[model samples]
Target: MTALDNSPNKIPSVTLDDVDSSVYSLYEKREKIFTRSIEGFFQNVRLFTGWPLLLGYFLTPWIMIDGRQAILFDLAARKFHIFWLTFWPQDFGFLAWALMIAAFTLFFITTLLGRVWCGYTCPQTVWTAIFMWAEQVAEGERHQRINLQKAPWSLEKVFKRFTKHGMWMGFAALTGLTFVSYFYGVRALVTDVWHFKLADTALFWSVFFTIATYANAGWLREQVCLHMCPYARFQSAMLDEDTLVVSYDPQRGELRGPRKRNADPDTLGLGACIDCFLCVQVCPTGIDIRDGLQYECINCAICIDACDSIMAKMNYAPGLISYTTENKLAGRGRTWKRPKLVGYGLAVILMITLFSYSLFTRMPLELDIMRNRGELYHEVADGLIRNTYLVKIINMDRKTHTYQLALSGLPAPRMVPDARIVAPAGEVVELSIDVLVDPDKLIEVNTEIEFRVETDDSLWYATSESRYLGPEPIRSQNND
Candidate 1:
């Protein structure tokens, strides 16, 4: 046989005279994420805030103040009730303004501090944490869970899996029911669900939401933040380099490899990191923070806790991974009051001011007047030309009101039968009224008259300026 190196298109064995430090060994398999339990100042803070927030979500539907649900968005009635305020469709502008204010606040917060909402306040994170906690309780800690996954099927394993999934479904069902309860009062919802009297739409939606919650929180926990949520994609636009984000100190963590705890770095020539991989263990998204700041990182700081603990054990200063800015880490002074953040702050302030002013100036009563089209002007007794108009009054308040109507810039304008109309809350009262003017006073076919209405209880007032139809007269006399 011909020598291997002498064969046509055959390559000789290659040797690396100088090994490249940047090149890494490739593994065919992926490592599993076993997030170790961590406890520290920030971890405790997160637990304190996260637990209460979860409790509030599950219990809010049952909470009642003054014989009514504390918060109810009644879609059927087209009313939103929050504490003492009841808003109708006519007051939808308030809702729009409120949404604008919320969007601006989110923008301002995101610009100032990156992904704080996603980390702490997001429902997905909260629900996923709760589900994971339930799983941990049922299946033991991360190590035990990993062991269980590797072990053969056993009665104990089956029981644990069944119990964990059962509890997850229970919590998800509760979440779905509570969400629906806001639209249909909790009491009514409980009664209907208990009696199996749910409408097809309600039952379908409730089941769908329950299934969605369970699958998302229990199964797709990190995937939701990484891929599904639009906020994760758009949040980058709101963030600047000045925004505080969880970052790794590459300057101190580079040349990372397994090393002795107290080994001299001058001899080994390695950075601060001992390559324990504790940060990866604590990350919910299962990413190495030392790799870089990834979009998947929710800035939850669990990795910070884990790394800090590792640093403490190594007798090194904490903050190998920390909440810091690129500039600060790059040896530049950092300030929270950066110009971009300040601009966002000012815009938020302006939007809030405008929203609050609009809310304060909103009128509770509305008047709509339509002039009679069949007969613009009709002759009344004593040579009087009368015009007919229809008035529709809408009341947005929570109480019934009696409104007294009056007409200005007319000889005599009054309601067809009377001058007062009563309108119940969230109801429209449409009635006809007439304005009589003497024929001698008529100089044109349409005369403008201001119609005003004041509630008897002094709650609201409205006005509509409409034209009173009349006859043109004395054309020859006005020729001069």
Candidate 2:
């Protein structure tokens, strides 16, 4: 209707053109994914593996050894107790090595199986699956639930929604409580919580974890797997064409047009694919593996199971989609003996060896020594010299121990009247001792002395070298 609109070759205003253009159109509102359930080898494996891991996390802390939590990271005391071994802050190198091993192991597994960890054992995936199971129990299956959601609110709908969310929140709190129980003894935590005596830090973290679990697993769901997990972003770098992943065999599934129920592939000039789309229905992450290797594919293989079931019903061979590598599917030679795997294997072995060696050779006791600089050497009232030294001993054990101090290369070091020292299971004990070495025996201003502490068991020993101070020896004039 305007003059510009009437002109055949009129140019549009820059602002008008820019307003119409976009780098990307507004994203379509996402459809909620409703994944169907499937049972198969991989599904069973994931289920069974997840249980033991979950049980270990929730149960290990309560296990006691020598009347103490068996695997406690007593941060308050700066000690880590694992079974019989106790790691103090001084044994931090092994912890670093252990972390390196874990990182490399993740990389190695990623390169071999391609997100198997994410699909099967990841806490996010497992928890989300559990939460969804609860949802499915409360609401009906996929299509029914969708219809229920689209329907107007009613008493039945409200009850179902409230029940589902209420159960989810309760489970989240239990998970949070289990997590915190690892730090605080589970029995103490339970009693303290019931009595309203839980520490602020403990209560704060429990609530934080509860809300996070509820949101991530119940509300956020696949969004966490897709957008929040950094692993999904970096997994591409760790994967190669040879890595086994859940893949759709395009060659065997091309020209996938629908046909008669019993249509023969040879007669119809079609590949084996029947285009049932069951593979798409069972994917928790809501991705189509048929689009080729995608970061969104968690290698869950539920799609493979669904396809296999359909294939069986159609009298066709299974594996139209399967746990396969791009190289193998592309007709390339497959070899599991790649150099990268071998290198990772060697590195894993080396790290394990180093970690074991460090643990085995760890000293049972630690010693620290410092000469009293507050007051330099004090001379006695006679022809004698005395030096003060402060010594601290740490007992790295699950039980208490007593240590007797000794000194060599010095005349005698006496405990000032009552200087006996005893260290608890994981404590540091310090003492001050004075050494009286005869001035006649002094050959130099500073004489070296060896200090030692021996535990009653004779299995632990610590030693350090310090110096005793005295007047410098006078040299006689040279005979000429």
Candidate 3:
């Protein structure tokens, strides 16, 4: 039995050292990744997804529908046009629901298949892939790129670097111009730039987006995903055991050692993996899948393609590194019926339904009635009570419209000015008019009035409610 040393002299004296936080930094410097090019099922899938995104982004602004850009987010005009529909600032509720739908949809997908959005559909990943391809075309393959990086300053190295950056700049400039076209009409903007007549704002934004695209896709690359993107930080909460993720099958790939092509792994006392680092070489983020699931892994499956190729060459079964579920790997049932996944799916569906309802019920005309707060009521001749109102008619349609205004609540009221308003497309028409009625017709000092606005074509109608203020009735005034 050991006795405790209670005496002060017997106890060992310890002193704490001042630890420099900078000495043990949590941050790791980013190493440039020269991802090896590979062609497989997943690469082909990227082609289908990535090419459409790039092409559609560049071409959609050029598409015209009903003499207007098919897809445009006119921030200056506060109008968003998509195909046949135009959303106004007043319809911002739809935007909120739309964002909710998008967020919940991403959550559902993340819960079902981890980080598939980042791998195949993310703008950063897609654009970065193009930039990487350009780099490879200019410098050469992954090994050649690495060699070029380490090579001393030479004409050939300078030429290769210049060519690579030139391609990136060209694409970035085109992307910027295309992005700006959604705000400024594509044809008009292109013509203006062609003639050196682009507006200062347009030129500024064009240059800004160009530099942004070039930097993000070419230079930042995985750093944007690892550090800047909030999705990577919160994706762990959305992921579940049943979620399909890019992973390495270490159980079937342990005891790693190099083996002859004809040698059996069983006799060599090794696993299926032949210690080839091709998977890590092909990873865009430069992460080793064998190290286990990491937040940095985009689930791009390039590593899977690289490993599959090596497996085929070595006469081994494929999917040594693949998109797989942890539950399946652990020999558990891999059903996707998780609670949070279902909840997210339901939320997405609910948001979609609400957005659809708002869209279908949307009207091209809107009405607003504002009573002059200065004087509640004005007395006129012939014992008449007059109330002034500022009427606003908003034309949200694609074409100009003549709207007719109607007021209700006071009996036999005469509108001093005409009730007709001519509103230009996506413009507001305001009317400062007076409504007069006999004092005997007034039931009370204050009355609720409804304003109805209808387009002359009868295609759209809208209504708003406001208060009508007047003095007490003649009978009540006499009684008082």
Candidate 4:
């Protein structure tokens, strides 16, 4: 044993030449996939569902509500207007809650329906679908487009490519314009565009969003779902056996082979699957559904459409590939009682309820009282102890408010000048006021006080708690 066995088995080392250096490389050249189009039940559903969403996206910014943009996010003004409601910077916590609710809702939907969001309602999918349609219109069908790619460059190729890219760029520009309109009023944005005089920020974001849309929808396409999206990577953690997913029924499709349309699958020892590979061809990610669930699958159900159409043509029962749960496909009875799903569902409901309640009960005004730190109390004539306060009032309503201020918790406390405040709509007004209290009423060095503000026009009211600093009560002569 000490002689040190020098045999190949005993002292194995990989030579530099023997090591597959390609495996150690960081990057891989990407393969382009041209997705073939298909039509079936799910395809029709996707198409129909996309129309209303697209219409809403394009048309929402143009809608007016109460003489202002309906759904404008006025970042410069720090105001968000949504139809009848308006939010200020202080309402940002509501936005955070809304985002959390949305996230939990997405999780709940994922736990129940897999990646249906990604497949249908996701912005990437919708834009990609539109871009693909444009490509088909410009470059023809999938096979023709593939042939065109392989063919040597020619006038026809240049023309087609230019047209396709032109259409894509136009769509991207439109999408960018629409997105920016949410921040800038749509009418103003449209006027700016017409005059070619967009503001610096507007121009920059428009160009940025346009380039992003073009790159994501036209060039990246499936690669966005495959390599870039983190959702594709982590979706497995959100999934379980009972969760519905687009799947291939291996039990019915395992002995897959081509046969005549009318051939008896039993006698021929075949299955419902004719091994046509249409599912793969139509798959945006270029994956085979028969190979079992993969992260690359978007659950678009295009494969299901393709397979079902093929089955219909072959006079075989459909659903060779379909939306189903792993438990059902495995002959286990479907169960919707999973703890994680129920938890996510309950969380979504709770968050929605909380957000709605908070929104409904939100006040239209905010007030903050900041005491002057330089001096706690000032002794002036007439045996009055004065405390200076910086009162900040924010009007969240759409109309200007004249608030009448009142003080309590001390006897005969009076404001030095006026107790009235005027705050413009969506504006913060800070006023310096001196609160005077009679020395006879001072029982302690610090006394709790309340500042109440009420609007003259409506029942809107807000209160701020503050402390009034006063001189210590004079000790009686006998006690001293």
Ten-residue segment with the worst summed lDDT in candidate 1?
Answer: 4-13
Off by over 4 Å in 2: 1-31, 408-421, 443-450, 465-480
Alpha-carbon lDDT of model 3? 0.86
Please, what are the lDDT tens digits per residue for candidate 4 over residues 17-131? 9868776646555667777888889998998878889999999998897789999999998899988888998899899999999888888889899999899888899999999
Highest lDDT model number: 4
lDDT of 2 by residue, 156-220 (tens): 99999999999899989989988888777788889999999999989998999999999999988
All predictions: root-mean-square deviation over Cα? Answer: 8.3, 7.5, 9.0, 8.2
Give TM-scores for every candidate, taking all chains together and pairing residue i with residue i.
0.84, 0.88, 0.91, 0.90
The parts of candidate 1 lying over 4 Å away from their true place are 1-34, 62-67, 150-154, 262-267, 371-390, 425-427, 434-441, 457-459, 465-467, 470-480
Whole-model alpha-carbon lDDT for candidate 4: 0.87
Q: How should the candidates be ordered by lDDT, best one leading? A: 4, 3, 2, 1
- Model 3 misplaced regions, further than 4 Å: 1-27, 399-402, 418-425, 455-460
**Local error of candidate 1 at 85, Å?**
1.9
Angstrom error of the Cα, residue 216, model 1: value is: 1.8
The alpha-carbon lDDT assigned to residue 192 of candidate 4 equals: 96
Q: Write the per-residue lDDT of candidate 3 for residues 365-446, one digit (tens) a residue.
A: 7788889999989888777778898888888877889888888887888888865789998788888989888878788888
Q: Single out the weakest 10-residue window by summed lDDT for candidate 4.
A: 2-11
Clashes of each: 0, 0, 0, 0
Give the true-structure RMSD of model 2: 7.5
Candidate 3 global TM-score: 0.91
Residue 247 local lDDT, model 2: 87
